[model samples]
Target: MLILGAFNLFVGRLYLIPSESMEPTLNGCAGCDGDRIFVNKLAYLGDSSPHPGDVVVFRGPDSWNGSYTSQRSRNDVIRGIQNAASVVGIIAPDENTLVKRVVATGGQTVQCRAGDPGIMVNGKKVDDEFTEKPMSNPVDPATGSQACQGPYFGPVTVPQDNLWVMGDNRTNSLDSRGHMGDELQGTVPVENVVGRVEAIVLPFGRTGFVDNPDIQHN
Candidate 1:
Protein backbone atom coordinates (compact mmCIF):
# COMPACT_ATOMS: atom_id res chain seq x y z
CA MET A 1 0.00 0.00 0.00
CA LEU A 2 2.82 2.41 0.77
CA ILE A 3 4.27 1.68 -2.62
CA LEU A 4 0.93 2.53 -4.27
CA GLY A 5 0.76 5.76 -2.31
CA ALA A 6 4.28 6.67 -3.29
CA PHE A 7 3.55 5.89 -6.90
CA ASN A 8 0.47 8.11 -6.82
CA LEU A 9 2.54 10.94 -5.37
CA PHE A 10 4.95 10.90 -8.28
CA VAL A 11 2.27 10.26 -10.93
CA GLY A 12 0.59 13.51 -9.88
CA ARG A 13 2.54 16.63 -9.01
CA LEU A 14 2.43 20.26 -7.89
CA TYR A 15 4.06 23.35 -9.46
CA LEU A 16 4.57 26.99 -8.62
CA ILE A 17 3.80 29.86 -10.91
CA PRO A 18 7.20 31.23 -11.87
CA SER A 19 6.50 33.64 -14.71
CA GLU A 20 4.23 36.49 -15.79
CA SER A 21 2.41 34.69 -18.56
CA MET A 22 -0.53 34.55 -16.15
CA GLU A 23 -1.04 37.73 -14.20
CA PRO A 24 -3.65 39.49 -12.02
CA THR A 25 -4.52 35.89 -11.24
CA LEU A 26 -2.44 32.99 -9.91
CA ASN A 27 0.28 35.58 -9.30
CA GLY A 28 2.54 34.00 -11.81
CA CYS A 29 5.33 36.05 -10.38
CA ALA A 30 3.60 38.64 -8.23
CA GLY A 31 4.28 42.20 -9.37
CA CYS A 32 5.13 40.37 -12.57
CA ASP A 33 7.87 38.64 -10.58
CA GLY A 34 8.10 35.58 -8.26
CA ASP A 35 7.29 31.88 -8.12
CA ARG A 36 3.95 30.82 -6.55
CA ILE A 37 1.10 28.61 -7.70
CA PHE A 38 0.03 25.08 -6.91
CA VAL A 39 -1.78 22.83 -9.39
CA ASN A 40 -3.85 19.67 -8.79
CA LYS A 41 -2.02 17.26 -11.04
CA LEU A 42 -5.15 15.15 -11.38
CA ALA A 43 -7.78 17.88 -11.70
CA TYR A 44 -8.69 16.78 -15.20
CA LEU A 45 -10.19 13.51 -14.11
CA GLY A 46 -13.84 14.35 -14.82
CA ASP A 47 -15.39 16.22 -17.73
CA SER A 48 -13.87 19.50 -16.66
CA SER A 49 -14.19 22.76 -18.45
CA PRO A 50 -11.34 25.20 -19.08
CA HIS A 51 -12.74 28.72 -19.11
CA PRO A 52 -11.34 31.88 -20.59
CA GLY A 53 -9.08 33.87 -18.26
CA ASP A 54 -8.47 30.82 -16.10
CA VAL A 55 -4.76 30.48 -15.46
CA VAL A 56 -3.94 27.04 -16.79
CA VAL A 57 -0.95 24.74 -16.52
CA PHE A 58 -0.12 22.40 -19.34
CA ARG A 59 2.55 20.30 -21.03
CA GLY A 60 3.13 21.87 -24.42
CA PRO A 61 3.66 19.55 -27.38
CA ASP A 62 7.13 18.20 -28.05
CA SER A 63 7.21 20.75 -30.85
CA TRP A 64 5.74 23.77 -29.05
CA ASN A 65 8.89 25.65 -28.07
CA GLY A 66 9.71 28.75 -26.04
CA SER A 67 12.01 31.45 -27.33
CA TYR A 68 13.57 32.16 -23.93
CA THR A 69 14.11 28.52 -23.07
CA SER A 70 15.93 27.65 -19.87
CA GLN A 71 16.21 24.37 -18.03
CA ARG A 72 16.31 26.36 -14.81
CA SER A 73 15.02 29.59 -13.36
CA ARG A 74 17.73 32.00 -12.24
CA ASN A 75 15.56 33.19 -9.35
CA ASP A 76 15.36 29.99 -7.35
CA VAL A 77 17.57 27.06 -6.38
CA ILE A 78 14.57 24.73 -5.91
CA ARG A 79 13.86 25.34 -9.55
CA GLY A 80 17.14 23.66 -10.35
CA ILE A 81 16.54 20.76 -7.98
CA GLN A 82 12.92 20.16 -8.98
CA ASN A 83 13.85 20.43 -12.60
CA ALA A 84 16.62 17.85 -12.39
CA ALA A 85 14.95 15.86 -15.17
CA SER A 86 15.78 18.47 -17.79
CA VAL A 87 17.53 16.10 -20.12
CA VAL A 88 14.40 13.98 -20.54
CA GLY A 89 11.75 16.76 -20.39
CA ILE A 90 10.30 15.28 -17.21
CA ILE A 91 11.25 16.71 -13.84
CA ALA A 92 13.06 19.84 -15.08
CA PRO A 93 10.68 21.06 -17.81
CA ASP A 94 13.10 20.56 -20.66
CA GLU A 95 11.22 23.62 -21.87
CA ASN A 96 7.72 22.29 -21.11
CA THR A 97 5.27 23.62 -18.46
CA LEU A 98 3.53 26.86 -19.42
CA VAL A 99 1.32 29.22 -17.42
CA LYS A 100 -0.99 31.17 -19.70
CA ARG A 101 -4.39 32.84 -19.84
CA VAL A 102 -7.09 30.93 -21.67
CA VAL A 103 -8.24 33.59 -24.11
CA ALA A 104 -10.32 31.48 -26.46
CA THR A 105 -11.00 27.78 -26.49
CA GLY A 106 -12.42 25.28 -28.97
CA GLY A 107 -14.20 27.34 -31.63
CA GLN A 108 -13.59 31.02 -31.15
CA THR A 109 -11.79 34.01 -32.61
CA VAL A 110 -9.68 36.43 -30.60
CA GLN A 111 -8.72 39.80 -31.98
CA CYS A 112 -6.64 42.59 -30.46
CA ARG A 113 -5.67 45.77 -32.26
CA ALA A 114 -3.47 48.61 -31.08
CA GLY A 115 -5.52 51.70 -30.24
CA ASP A 116 -8.56 49.43 -30.15
CA PRO A 117 -8.73 49.42 -26.34
CA GLY A 118 -9.60 45.70 -25.82
CA ILE A 119 -9.69 42.10 -26.99
CA MET A 120 -12.60 41.13 -29.20
CA VAL A 121 -14.17 37.68 -29.11
CA ASN A 122 -16.38 36.90 -32.07
CA GLY A 123 -16.46 40.68 -32.81
CA LYS A 124 -17.30 41.69 -29.25
CA LYS A 125 -14.68 43.00 -26.88
CA VAL A 126 -13.89 40.55 -24.12
CA ASP A 127 -14.29 41.84 -20.58
CA ASP A 128 -10.81 43.07 -19.75
CA GLU A 129 -11.41 43.47 -16.02
CA PHE A 130 -8.85 41.02 -14.68
CA THR A 131 -6.12 41.56 -17.23
CA GLU A 132 -3.24 43.87 -16.36
CA LYS A 133 -3.36 45.28 -19.91
CA PRO A 134 -5.08 44.92 -23.26
CA MET A 135 -4.03 42.10 -25.62
CA SER A 136 -2.85 44.32 -28.43
CA ASN A 137 0.81 43.82 -29.03
CA PRO A 138 2.21 42.91 -32.48
CA VAL A 139 4.67 40.12 -33.24
CA ASP A 140 7.61 40.17 -35.64
CA PRO A 141 7.86 36.77 -37.33
CA ALA A 142 11.47 37.37 -38.24
CA THR A 143 12.58 37.88 -34.66
CA GLY A 144 9.75 35.84 -32.99
CA SER A 145 9.08 38.65 -30.49
CA GLN A 146 6.93 41.71 -29.82
CA ALA A 147 9.27 43.57 -27.48
CA CYS A 148 11.88 44.45 -30.10
CA GLN A 149 9.20 46.53 -31.96
CA GLY A 150 5.55 46.34 -33.05
CA PRO A 151 3.21 47.26 -35.94
CA TYR A 152 2.20 43.54 -36.25
CA PHE A 153 -1.16 41.87 -36.91
CA GLY A 154 -4.94 41.87 -36.57
CA PRO A 155 -8.21 39.71 -36.77
CA VAL A 156 -6.55 36.45 -35.73
CA THR A 157 -9.01 33.54 -35.51
CA VAL A 158 -8.20 30.78 -33.08
CA PRO A 159 -8.85 27.52 -34.90
CA GLN A 160 -10.95 24.67 -33.58
CA ASP A 161 -9.32 22.10 -31.25
CA ASN A 162 -6.74 24.77 -30.38
CA LEU A 163 -6.87 27.18 -27.49
CA TRP A 164 -5.69 30.77 -27.94
CA VAL A 165 -3.49 31.82 -25.05
CA MET A 166 -1.73 35.02 -24.02
CA GLY A 167 0.09 36.70 -21.21
CA ASP A 168 -1.41 39.48 -19.11
CA ASN A 169 1.53 41.80 -19.69
CA ARG A 170 0.51 42.62 -23.24
CA THR A 171 3.52 44.57 -24.39
CA ASN A 172 6.04 42.10 -23.03
CA SER A 173 4.15 38.85 -23.57
CA LEU A 174 4.79 36.24 -26.26
CA ASP A 175 1.48 34.50 -26.94
CA SER A 176 -1.00 33.36 -29.60
CA ARG A 177 -0.35 36.39 -31.76
CA GLY A 178 3.38 35.78 -31.86
CA HIS A 179 3.62 34.06 -35.23
CA MET A 180 0.24 33.79 -36.89
CA GLY A 181 -0.21 31.26 -34.11
CA ASP A 182 3.08 29.80 -35.24
CA GLU A 183 2.62 26.06 -35.64
CA LEU A 184 4.95 24.22 -33.25
CA GLN A 185 5.79 27.76 -32.20
CA GLY A 186 2.57 29.16 -30.61
CA THR A 187 -1.07 28.27 -29.87
CA VAL A 188 -1.88 25.54 -27.37
CA PRO A 189 -4.04 22.53 -28.12
CA VAL A 190 -6.91 21.61 -25.80
CA GLU A 191 -5.27 18.25 -25.24
CA ASN A 192 -2.22 19.99 -23.82
CA VAL A 193 -4.01 21.54 -20.82
CA VAL A 194 -3.72 19.59 -17.58
CA GLY A 195 -5.52 21.81 -15.08
CA ARG A 196 -6.43 25.37 -14.11
CA VAL A 197 -4.00 27.14 -11.87
CA GLU A 198 -5.79 27.93 -8.61
CA ALA A 199 -3.38 29.85 -6.34
CA ILE A 200 -0.06 31.19 -5.20
CA VAL A 201 1.42 29.03 -2.44
CA LEU A 202 4.69 30.81 -1.72
CA PRO A 203 6.06 34.27 -0.97
CA PHE A 204 3.61 35.30 1.77
CA GLY A 205 2.51 38.42 -0.09
CA ARG A 206 1.28 36.42 -3.04
CA THR A 207 -0.50 33.35 -1.73
CA GLY A 208 -4.17 32.47 -2.20
CA PHE A 209 -6.77 31.18 -4.66
CA VAL A 210 -6.44 32.66 -8.16
CA ASP A 211 -8.83 35.53 -9.00
CA ASN A 212 -9.25 36.15 -12.74
CA PRO A 213 -13.01 35.39 -12.70
CA ASP A 214 -14.47 37.76 -15.26
CA ILE A 215 -13.25 35.88 -18.33
CA GLN A 216 -16.04 35.15 -20.85
CA HIS A 217 -15.38 33.44 -24.18
CA ASN A 218 -17.75 33.32 -27.11
Candidate 2:
Protein backbone atom coordinates (compact mmCIF):
# COMPACT_ATOMS: atom_id res chain seq x y z
CA MET A 1 0.00 0.00 0.00
CA LEU A 2 2.47 2.63 -1.21
CA ILE A 3 2.76 5.58 -3.57
CA LEU A 4 2.88 9.30 -2.85
CA GLY A 5 0.63 8.17 0.00
CA ALA A 6 -1.56 11.24 -0.20
CA PHE A 7 -4.44 9.74 1.77
CA ASN A 8 -5.07 6.71 -0.43
CA LEU A 9 -7.32 8.45 -2.93
CA PHE A 10 -8.15 5.45 -5.08
CA VAL A 11 -8.98 2.86 -2.45
CA GLY A 12 -10.91 5.14 -0.11
CA ARG A 13 -11.82 3.77 3.33
CA LEU A 14 -14.41 1.34 1.96
CA TYR A 15 -17.67 0.95 3.94
CA LEU A 16 -19.69 -2.18 3.35
CA ILE A 17 -23.33 -1.20 3.83
CA PRO A 18 -24.70 -3.44 6.57
CA SER A 19 -27.72 -1.87 8.29
CA GLU A 20 -31.20 -0.57 7.48
CA SER A 21 -30.77 2.52 9.69
CA MET A 22 -30.69 4.97 6.79
CA GLU A 23 -32.93 2.99 4.48
CA PRO A 24 -34.77 4.49 1.45
CA THR A 25 -31.84 6.91 1.57
CA LEU A 26 -28.80 4.60 1.61
CA ASN A 27 -28.83 0.88 1.17
CA GLY A 28 -27.15 -1.27 3.82
CA CYS A 29 -25.98 -4.24 1.83
CA ALA A 30 -22.52 -3.54 0.40
CA GLY A 31 -23.67 -5.49 -2.62
CA CYS A 32 -27.35 -6.10 -1.88
CA ASP A 33 -28.53 -4.95 -5.30
CA GLY A 34 -27.78 -1.44 -4.01
CA ASP A 35 -25.37 1.46 -4.43
CA ARG A 36 -22.00 2.09 -2.70
CA ILE A 37 -20.88 5.36 -1.12
CA PHE A 38 -17.56 7.03 -0.32
CA VAL A 39 -16.95 8.87 2.93
CA ASN A 40 -14.82 11.95 2.31
CA LYS A 41 -13.15 12.42 5.69
CA LEU A 42 -11.74 15.71 4.55
CA ALA A 43 -15.11 17.36 3.85
CA TYR A 44 -15.28 18.93 7.28
CA LEU A 45 -11.60 19.70 7.78
CA GLY A 46 -12.00 23.40 7.02
CA ASP A 47 -14.04 25.90 9.07
CA SER A 48 -17.35 24.37 8.00
CA SER A 49 -20.39 22.72 9.52
CA PRO A 50 -22.91 19.93 8.82
CA HIS A 51 -26.47 20.31 7.57
CA PRO A 52 -29.67 18.28 7.90
CA GLY A 53 -29.95 14.91 6.10
CA ASP A 54 -26.27 14.78 5.27
CA VAL A 55 -25.25 11.14 5.65
CA VAL A 56 -21.98 10.92 7.58
CA VAL A 57 -19.31 8.74 9.16
CA PHE A 58 -17.94 9.46 12.63
CA ARG A 59 -15.75 7.93 15.37
CA GLY A 60 -18.15 6.53 17.99
CA PRO A 61 -17.55 6.68 21.75
CA ASP A 62 -16.17 4.43 24.57
CA SER A 63 -18.53 1.80 23.32
CA TRP A 64 -15.26 0.55 21.89
CA ASN A 65 -12.63 2.66 23.70
CA GLY A 66 -9.45 0.73 24.67
CA SER A 67 -10.97 -2.69 24.29
CA TYR A 68 -11.56 -2.91 20.58
CA THR A 69 -8.76 -0.84 19.17
CA SER A 70 -6.28 -2.24 21.69
CA GLN A 71 -4.29 -5.44 21.75
CA ARG A 72 -6.06 -6.23 25.05
CA SER A 73 -8.71 -8.83 25.96
CA ARG A 74 -10.78 -11.54 24.34
CA ASN A 75 -13.74 -9.18 24.04
CA ASP A 76 -11.38 -6.79 22.32
CA VAL A 77 -10.99 -9.30 19.53
CA ILE A 78 -14.72 -9.67 19.30
CA ARG A 79 -15.04 -5.88 19.53
CA GLY A 80 -12.74 -5.58 16.56
CA ILE A 81 -15.21 -7.52 14.47
CA GLN A 82 -18.23 -5.75 15.93
CA ASN A 83 -16.60 -2.35 15.55
CA ALA A 84 -16.10 -2.88 11.85
CA ALA A 85 -19.72 -3.91 11.57
CA SER A 86 -20.69 -0.80 13.54
CA VAL A 87 -18.87 1.40 11.05
CA VAL A 88 -21.11 0.30 8.22
CA GLY A 89 -24.25 0.72 10.36
CA ILE A 90 -24.48 -3.07 10.70
CA ILE A 91 -23.93 -3.38 14.45
CA ALA A 92 -25.93 -1.08 16.70
CA PRO A 93 -23.01 0.74 18.30
CA ASP A 94 -22.59 -0.71 21.75
CA GLU A 95 -19.28 0.96 20.89
CA ASN A 96 -19.36 2.56 17.45
CA THR A 97 -19.54 5.66 15.23
CA LEU A 98 -22.91 6.41 13.63
CA VAL A 99 -24.32 7.77 10.40
CA LYS A 100 -27.50 9.82 10.88
CA ARG A 101 -29.48 12.89 10.00
CA VAL A 102 -28.38 16.14 11.68
CA VAL A 103 -31.97 17.00 12.52
CA ALA A 104 -31.44 19.75 15.07
CA THR A 105 -28.32 21.75 15.69
CA GLY A 106 -26.55 23.92 18.34
CA GLY A 107 -29.44 26.09 19.48
CA GLN A 108 -32.64 24.85 17.97
CA THR A 109 -35.60 23.32 19.76
CA VAL A 110 -36.92 20.11 18.26
CA GLN A 111 -39.85 17.92 19.23
CA CYS A 112 -41.81 14.92 18.01
CA ARG A 113 -44.48 12.44 19.07
CA ALA A 114 -45.29 8.78 18.65
CA GLY A 115 -48.77 9.70 17.50
CA ASP A 116 -47.85 12.00 14.63
CA PRO A 117 -45.07 11.29 12.12
CA GLY A 118 -44.21 15.00 11.89
CA ILE A 119 -41.28 16.61 13.70
CA MET A 120 -41.77 19.98 15.35
CA VAL A 121 -38.79 22.29 15.35
CA ASN A 122 -39.19 25.49 17.36
CA GLY A 123 -42.94 25.00 17.33
CA LYS A 124 -43.05 24.51 13.56
CA LYS A 125 -44.08 21.40 11.70
CA VAL A 126 -41.45 19.46 9.78
CA ASP A 127 -43.56 16.75 8.22
CA ASP A 128 -40.83 14.96 6.41
CA GLU A 129 -41.64 12.66 3.51
CA PHE A 130 -38.20 11.18 3.99
CA THR A 131 -39.22 9.97 7.44
CA GLU A 132 -40.68 6.50 7.02
CA LYS A 133 -42.32 3.83 9.11
CA PRO A 134 -40.03 1.47 11.02
CA MET A 135 -38.71 -1.02 8.49
CA SER A 136 -37.65 -4.56 9.30
CA ASN A 137 -34.19 -5.72 8.35
CA PRO A 138 -32.17 -8.44 10.06
CA VAL A 139 -28.85 -6.73 9.49
CA ASP A 140 -28.98 -4.46 12.55
CA PRO A 141 -28.51 -5.61 16.14
CA ALA A 142 -29.92 -2.63 18.08
CA THR A 143 -32.92 -3.38 20.29
CA GLY A 144 -34.89 -0.32 19.22
CA SER A 145 -34.91 -1.43 15.59
CA GLN A 146 -36.62 -4.62 16.51
CA ALA A 147 -39.07 -3.17 19.03
CA CYS A 148 -40.19 0.24 17.84
CA GLN A 149 -43.34 1.31 15.98
CA GLY A 150 -42.15 4.92 15.86
CA PRO A 151 -42.69 8.54 15.38
CA TYR A 152 -40.53 9.34 18.46
CA PHE A 153 -40.86 12.36 20.76
CA GLY A 154 -39.52 15.07 23.14
CA PRO A 155 -39.87 18.90 23.23
CA VAL A 156 -36.27 19.57 24.22
CA THR A 157 -33.84 22.20 23.05
CA VAL A 158 -30.51 21.39 21.49
CA PRO A 159 -27.65 21.77 23.98
CA GLN A 160 -25.09 24.52 23.63
CA ASP A 161 -22.57 22.29 21.93
CA ASN A 162 -24.57 19.22 21.06
CA LEU A 163 -26.47 17.74 18.17
CA TRP A 164 -29.85 16.00 17.85
CA VAL A 165 -29.78 13.15 15.37
CA MET A 166 -32.29 10.58 14.17
CA GLY A 167 -32.15 7.78 11.70
CA ASP A 168 -34.13 7.89 8.47
CA ASN A 169 -35.53 4.50 9.28
CA ARG A 170 -37.32 5.65 12.45
CA THR A 171 -38.31 2.29 13.88
CA ASN A 172 -34.91 0.69 13.86
CA SER A 173 -32.54 3.36 15.15
CA LEU A 174 -31.53 4.28 18.71
CA ASP A 175 -30.32 7.80 18.17
CA SER A 176 -30.67 10.96 20.29
CA ARG A 177 -33.96 9.52 21.48
CA GLY A 178 -32.16 6.73 23.32
CA HIS A 179 -28.86 8.60 23.74
CA MET A 180 -29.75 9.90 27.17
CA GLY A 181 -28.00 9.75 30.56
CA ASP A 182 -29.71 12.03 33.08
CA GLU A 183 -28.14 15.45 32.50
CA LEU A 184 -26.58 14.23 29.30
CA GLN A 185 -29.80 13.12 27.67
CA GLY A 186 -30.94 14.02 24.16
CA THR A 187 -27.63 15.52 23.19
CA VAL A 188 -24.38 14.49 21.57
CA PRO A 189 -21.21 16.54 22.09
CA VAL A 190 -20.77 18.78 19.09
CA GLU A 191 -17.21 17.65 18.62
CA ASN A 192 -18.35 14.05 18.64
CA VAL A 193 -19.82 14.61 15.20
CA VAL A 194 -17.11 14.18 12.58
CA GLY A 195 -18.63 15.47 9.30
CA ARG A 196 -21.53 15.47 6.85
CA VAL A 197 -22.13 12.57 4.46
CA GLU A 198 -21.24 13.66 0.97
CA ALA A 199 -22.07 11.03 -1.67
CA ILE A 200 -22.96 7.51 -2.70
CA VAL A 201 -20.28 5.87 -4.87
CA LEU A 202 -21.76 2.44 -5.35
CA PRO A 203 -24.81 0.69 -6.87
CA PHE A 204 -24.07 2.24 -10.27
CA GLY A 205 -27.20 4.39 -10.74
CA ARG A 206 -27.32 5.96 -7.25
CA THR A 207 -23.71 7.18 -7.26
CA GLY A 208 -23.43 10.75 -5.91
CA PHE A 209 -23.73 12.73 -2.65
CA VAL A 210 -26.82 11.94 -0.60
CA ASP A 211 -29.75 14.21 -1.37
CA ASN A 212 -32.82 15.14 0.67
CA PRO A 213 -35.61 17.71 0.74
CA ASP A 214 -34.71 21.01 2.38
CA ILE A 215 -35.26 21.17 6.14
CA GLN A 216 -37.80 23.99 5.71
CA HIS A 217 -41.08 23.78 3.90
CA ASN A 218 -42.65 26.58 1.88
Pairs clashing within candidate 1:
17-37, 83-92
TM-score of each: 0.68, 0.67
**lDDT by candidate, in order shown:** 0.61, 0.60
**1-218: candidate 2 lDDT, tens digit per residue:** 24412333322344545667777787774446644556665655657666555566665544313334433237877878876554454434443556777777777887765443466677666645675543554423332222233534577788776677777877766677765543546566667765556678776787876774557552
lDDT of 1 at 177: 67
Off by more than 4 A, model 2: 2-12, 29-35, 63-95, 114-117, 133-152
